[model samples]
Target: MIEFHLDGRSGVAPYMQLIQQVRQALRLGLLREGDRLPTIKDVVAKVAINPNTVLKAYRELEYEGLVTARPGVGTFVARTLNEEAGAVEPLRVELRAWLRRAQAAGLDPESIEALFATTFRIQLQESA
Candidate 1:
């Protein structure tokens, strides 16, 4: 199962956090095509957050063409690679901003690498 954690004091909204995590997973080549995600209820239970939050995140992911959800069946990651490659320039800017903030917060490269590794493993297991 994919494990999701929340920082109660984080300035980011729960849905935003979920969206960012999924995006990071995609960018880092963690989740791949045909990878299914947990149901909204399951995500709620795992993250200890409201189901609406998960739904919101899923909606945003859908908007980005990163995932698709069908009634009865759960949401699945998009099978297409480079689906968002056209937006790479903007994404690069965003990544740079995020990296600056992380660096300012004293999160070194090793810690960032570890975070990516852990998230990737969970996503792989969930997809498997």
Candidate 2:
């Protein structure tokens, strides 16, 4: 089973965090087609979030064709976003090196995260 986690201080919305978790799971091969996601009740109970939030996240996944929900059953994984398992390691290594440099430059964890977030947002806007 895939477990959902949230970072309350991450500045991203909860629904978006859930959607990203599903996508990340798909890319990392942690989830496969036909795998049922946690029930909305279960997610709300475990994560202490509103049921509507969970539903919204699931609906977004369905809209993206990454999941399908049965009327009475549950949401199931419908597709994967990645097939290459090794593709993330090089990026992870580069990220680690960047982190090291940031720390050496006297940047704290929060500062580095903020800088990265700002840079990522700009990159996303440019690409779009």
Candidate 3:
């Protein structure tokens, strides 16, 4: 099961946010094919959103062939986006250490994120 959270400040529609979270989970190997998603009732209780919002997200995911809904059971992941699980942990550890170094240099979280985003964009542009 995956826990979902919303960021009201993200400017993304709530239903889209749900869909993105599911996609991100799939990419991160947190959600695998055949895993059951939280029921609409459970998501409504947890996030206090309209049930239709969850249904819409699930439907969109189904359309993408990432998930399927069974009539009386629950929604399940039908495919995953994860490619390489073995490489993620080491990169995560290195990123954590880099974050600590940035904090030690007196950069706040916002500054660190901005720096990372800027550098990431530059790298992408250079590669392109």
For residues 1-128, could you state the per-residue lDDT of candidate 2 as single tens digits?
Answer: 68888899999999999999999889878999889999999998899998999999999999999999998988899888876657778888999999999999999999999999999999999999
- Per-candidate local distance difference test: 0.83, 0.92, 0.95
Model 1 alpha-carbon drift over 4 Å, by segment = 79-128
Score residue 121 of candidate 1 by CA lDDT.
100
Cα lDDT of model 1 by residue, 33-105, tens digit: 8888788988887778999899999999899888999889889997545567779879889988977888888
Which regions of candidate 3 are displaced past 4 Å?
Answer: 84-128
Per-candidate clash tally: 0, 0, 0
TM-scores of the candidates are 0.61, 0.73, 0.68
Q: Highest lDDT: which candidate?
A: 3
In angstroms, the error of model 2 at 16 is: 1.2
Between prediction 1 and prediction 3, the one with superior lDDT is: 3
TM-score of 2: 0.73
The positional error of residue 30 in candidate 1, measured at the CA in angstroms, is 1.5
